[model samples]
Target: MHAIPVSQSLPETLDPNIFSSPSSPKVGSEPQGHITEQVQTIWNPYKNRYRVLASCILSFANGMNDSAPGALIASLERDYNIAYGTVSIIFVCNALGFIAAAFFISTLSTRIGRAKSLMISEALLMIGYTAIVTTPPFGVVAASFFVTGVGMAMNLAICQVFCANLANNTALVGAYQGAYGIGGIFGPLIATALVSRGSKWSRFYIIELCLAALNFGIAPRTFWKYEQESKSLLPQPASEQQDRERGTVKRNDRTKRQWQSFKTLMSNKPTVLGALFIFAYQGSEVAISGWIISFLVQFRHGDPSKVGFVTSGFWAGITLGRFTLSFLAHRIGERTFVFFVTVGALILELLIWFVPSIPGDSVAVAFSGLLLGPVYPCAVHVFQRLIPRKMQISSLSLIGSVGSSGGAVAPFMTGMLAQHVGTFVLHPICIGLFVCMGISWFLLPKAERRDE
Candidate 1:
């Protein structure tokens, strides 16, 4: 086994070989020669910048694919003359698809390279979007969404792992996720504008399909260059040094370590509390976005076109909030920042519920978006800090999958509630979830302060 240097901190330029090669040296207990080779592979400024940019673009694609479907639902329902309850089945299908993919596709990504997995996912998205645009039957539409959900599941699960590998500092994970917020903001806004101008809703899918294609097409060339540059830094492995050069740890040890880390994560009080916080945060976000159009049109008596724009405004606020807070949270503190934002979100939700005019309600909803934006990503950032790096993908996937159940359940409940009571009731429920998030935020264990 060839010994290789492994840092306490993750290297900026991660070689696919480090993760893939069975013969690679164990970290922390490698031989002197292996240590020298690994040290040489440390990320430089330019390489780090490239990885950051690549990860951000991947995140942007994730946001664009995710937000587009929800935003287009209003127009789809109108054109199809479907009941709101029936329209909501799309979300359920999407969520179920996500959950299924979380269990199945993410494991596939680990076996096939992350890059190939991502590329396949984007291609699936293109196919799904094409199906939605070309096919007419409601069942087909739902099936299309399910297919997209698989892609979304793969994208969300893998993108962060990719980013986490790229980032030298664990602290920047939230900021990296913030780029997704930017994509979320623009995607819906652009889709809304297109729909408002009387473009067919199917056009949105076509545009997204093309974008996914473009992203997939460019990935191989760029990522290959990155991989090569990263690999060159490591020392050539000795031909006969199989056992010694492979270092102290075995594959079974790595697997055991990952499982132990996950067990540690599940048992940790702070991690559970943080996951709960994410659950509430995601539930509230989905409730608002999923029900906003119905609320505006059915209860508040706003125009469909105008409501679409209002919904986009809400996403815009979320995007802006994430970008602003990504930098600010590192400066202040995650706990303190979460406290302030949760309070603001609660207040904004109340204002959104009570406000009379569409314009006033729209403005309030936008502000609520801003306040709600930072909570989830920051919670994720905190979780990453608490857990071991090797286990981050599996642990995060497990937690995120659980929290995303809220994304599924909330919309379903909203549909049921609207059927029984009225669409306007979603506001009160959202406000209540925000309150729960705020309380949960306080319950999370505070990270020890480190001089930044």
Candidate 2:
């Protein structure tokens, strides 16, 4: 394929097909008005810059919304008069939302297009946040959690896919995920400050609501009319659209496509291993923060009021690790570095579990987060190269959803066990999960290309 140079100034009327990819433009296509402006708007190099900005916004919001609960769980327990076991059920609801979104989001993306589907997801976030901002009834609050989880799942799936496509290489993708770490660090602090001041915990959600609303306005415009729109805008022969539809049947068509995509994704060796690896990785990672404060307060006898901030330090390490370690992963190679980081994390997990001092455990937790930080972006980077391009988005979506469900399930089970045995189980369970992660990584199909 040869490149077509976009003009600095196209004529008043030019072929609508001029916006097509490097492939030759179709002849006899209708000439459209304002072709120059459209070219600058859609195909300009600066458009990707704008998309990167959108990706950061979504990443920050993702961290803020998901991580805040780590800081707010105590407040939720107190305000709702719930037990640890009961509060853990909320994690199940959230996981349910992520699992449910995984099954249908690819089809949704196919039907409405990714950009519009992303906008709808953002809108769902707004509604969920608004629902939670009030000191509502317990049932209402729980339902709100489910709604917000659905929004987060869809946003994450779309965000990962969009950025993977837009990023030129692994380093760029790492930078994008680094922004997520920064957001995750800030997320808990926002909630902690409000709680520390004796303000209503519900007020914490107000900030999330505002951010969601801002992204709701910006993301659609940033991602408007991606791949599908390109097909629609280019002038296909009049017979082409008809010929394409003639062979397709309407009956059960959408369901078949979703199931087929799911099956294909699950059947791929690299995809299955990648998904399982994340399922273990996020499971272990989230379990640490979700249970760390409780572990400290209940078992380590750390001040109940102060231990929650320890989660901030944990996420801060994650932020710094992604920001700093990503560059190093780029230099040392992602696959090799990931193995070292995971093993290092295993050593740190043991320190947290066996050392048993509040200060020692806290430091170990932060260090573990640092070691674990680069894995997510690095995994996404590998998937981009390893998965067949045709199946990338669907496979990645499944991986993301299953992985996020792991995040929910790990913490939920920890809470259930904590209910019986006590929070002392936190670090040991985390250690075991990380060990499982090590085995999964060993089984993963190696990428054909090495990191640049």
TM value for model 1? 0.81
Q: Provide TM-scores for the models.
A: 0.81, 0.83
Predicted candidate 1 versus true structure: per-residue lDDT over 1-452, tens digit per residue: 00011111111123233332211224655444343224211156255555556656767766665566556777877788876677778877877777777545644644565568768878888888889778478888888878877776776655555455443434345555666766677767777788889887877777777777876775533444444454465533454246446686476866675556556657866657765776677778877877887788887888776677676677778877776765687688777888888888888877777877788888988988887776666776676565443344445556676677667677778877787787877878887887888887787666643222
lDDT of 2 by residue, 214-301 (tens): 9888987877766544454444444534655796535476456546655666688887887788888888877887778887877788
For model 1, what is the C-alpha lDDT against the true structure?
0.65
lDDT of each: 0.65, 0.70
What lDDT does candidate 2 reach at residue 123? 91
Which consecutive 10 residues in model 1 have the weakest lDDT in total?
Answer: 1-10
Model 2 is weakest, by summed lDDT over 10 consecutive residues, at 1-10
**Candidate 2: stretches off by over 4 Å:** 1-45, 227-242, 245-261, 450-452
- Candidate No. with top lDDT: 2
